[model samples]
Target: MTITRGRFGHYKLLKNTKRLSPHVPDIHVYSESVLTSLLNNLQPLFIRPLLGPELIRIIKSGETYNLVVNDNEPIVTDRKSIVPCLIKQLHPKKTYIIQVNPTISYTPCRTFYTLQRKREGANWKTVHKTVQDTECTPRYMNFLIHWKLNRFLLAVAGKLGDAFVGCHTMVLEIGYAEGAFFLYDTILHERNSKWSQYQSFIRSRTIRPFMPHTDLCTKSTLKAFLRNYGKAIIKPAVGQQGKGIVKITIMPSGDFEVQKRNNLSTYKTFDALFQSIHSLHLSREDYIIQYYIALGIVDGCPFDVRVITQFDEEYGWIATGKLVKVAAPGYFITNRAQKLLAVEEVLSVPDSHIEQVCINGSIALSAQLNNLSIIGFDIGVEEGGKVWVIEANHVPSIAMFHNFGNNEMHTKITQFIGKRRRSLSENRKEEG
Candidate 1:
């Protein structure tokens, strides 16, 4: 793709590809007067109810009225009587508009609109929102179908790109929450890469094999993971709000215990722990068991840092935001459901290292993800200065940051989008 800048905007021009030829219709020009004459000639009796009173008056008064046609003919016999005719003439390969809601509608081929509903009293109002050509329709059924089909086609195209262009990239998520993997895969495919890029990168770094819940039957792999890290956390692969997480730790005296929400606790031995994991009966496909990283504590509470990476028009791979999440008292997770703390309050170590670790982690993650334009990295530093990655989330929650009254994250995101828009406008100019 060749990106060019001009007065209009940034536009991409395909190189070395045959330009599509325009196909002219046999009847190319239908004069407005001719169309009006045709409508005028229609019988009033046949058209009256069809056009509706408001539309009929407009047509009689020589005002513009919309028309709807099928097979080159108006569908309603009484054209004048029809309500303001929103005439959409269909051609062999012409685009059409389908209104899904008051606020949002979509053109047949170009865009999809996603609309949100706001409830006021007993009525609902729709809010039209446009997302980068990807979300153009408000119909859930159509949206899902489009997404699946697009993903499949993108995957095939990505394979072709890999073979020809060899432009491969990795995807990393720091917080693997429910929607995290979905967004990661979405971005990967959108950028013409395979979801395997994410999985492969993660698996290659860990010494022991990490198994999704589905592979839990493999006792050897499970034991290896537990022994290597001395503890393991079993969590739902597609969970949010820090729900359904069990931290399994083996004490120095050889006793084992499982920690969960609401202070629920279970004591177990090695055999018992294995049984407990099996008894949960969670779909192995939807869960993951990983070695737990004992992140350093602040005031005896564990905390982690979240780093957001975004592409900069001037400086690439800039760290957009950083914040510390402190776990609630007697809890292992630092989600909102847990407690949140400031960076200074969380890290027991020197303050200088906090920024340094965050900067280093952000850079490393950005490179690992093949210089992905956007990502959120969660980093944990142990008491002994061992930094471990908990996970990588592509669309980490910015709600918490916003709630905390921090505008830095919002500003960075806005700047990133603005730069892209300006780049797009520039490219359009060169194309013209």
Candidate 2:
């Protein structure tokens, strides 16, 4: 493998790598024609500088493009004027490239991280670093270990080190999108502290069996799902707090009933139902169509279990906490729970079984991704006592444990995070 100098060089190297070629998104040097063509083809595309971390996103909507710059509000621009808007927003005399955004049904809540490793005597050890992203600023927070992905990354790092023998360290920007991993940029001769967020899709091949049937929402997909299951849950691909979730059920009269929160609307035909959902939710952001699980109900309200699992190098995966969140009155989403109870009280499944399933799912994710230390599993227990993983939260809320009277698990999570922080500090001292 050859050491790639700039973004283009990195792309070329990644393209040539046998293991990484298929994951690479279509990219091109910036030109007005290229931009026009990409805007025509890809829904949301990235335009980034060749050398810096600054980025621009152009998303197509109706007849205009929503031009966004790095987490900012999108400014609407027409097709002919998008290049000029980029010129005004970007710095002069810098080269930029356009990349197709590769995310489909990305998780709503996720933490950003950077992985760093040092090579010595044919072995590589991670230089543990933790970065906490805040509302206004992004800084290094944590080091997560994905055993298999780590090995592959380190192999690439070793090749880079061999190619640039004199260069001590290089920072590579790797991303996961649509199930495969891609290396998009590399910073050499210096440490690039720029923060890049990577999206982790839980529907990786290994973890799919434990999850319910899920697919990106489209007319055909939604129709197929509804046809097969007679019901579907349409949720934002990137959302939290149980927001923007709509349930559509096929009535006995062959009508579609769309329910959002407390309100319900009826449509006569599948096309009418699809059109209503598309305008109300799908057109704004990405959404997924899922087979609606009829969760076990407590006093007529459906409830789901939240199981917290953490990874430990010494003892393997640990299931730290379990609690049942019953949906509020008139609302099916459990985020606004009317009551929380112990898991064993509500469901027939054994505690041991739920713990094993959650831990196994966590491990399976780690095999495919450089995943987080902690993952939260939203599990639905059916009336028949079957368990289905509804969703996996990468940044699962920890404070909720206290509300469920699980102080022991909350403290354990706090200690676990503190230990990681201390390890990160020790690694930094050694590097210094």
Q: Which one wins on lDDT?
A: 2
Q: TM-score: which candidate is best?
A: 2
Kindly list the per-residue Cα lDDT of model 2 for residues 1-432, writing each as its tens digit: 455465666666666667655655666888888887787674468787776556677877789888977545689988889988987877678777788756455421222223333222344333322211122122222333245446655666565555654333344455543344555445543211111111122324544455777655656667778889999998865677888889999999999998898788899997677767766676555466778999888989999999988876667789888889999988877888999888778877899888887887777555533535888889898999888888777788987887657388788877877876777789899999
TM per candidate: 0.46, 0.57
Q: Rate the local accuracy (lDDT) of all candidates.
A: 0.42, 0.67
* Clash totals for all candidate models: 41, 7
| Deviating ranges (above 4 Å) for candidate 2 | 1-208
Off by over 4 Å in 1: 1-217, 237-240, 251-255, 267-269, 281-286, 337-339, 344-371, 421-432
Which residue pairs clash within candidate 2?
130-140, 130-141, 130-142, 131-140, 131-141, 131-142, 132-141
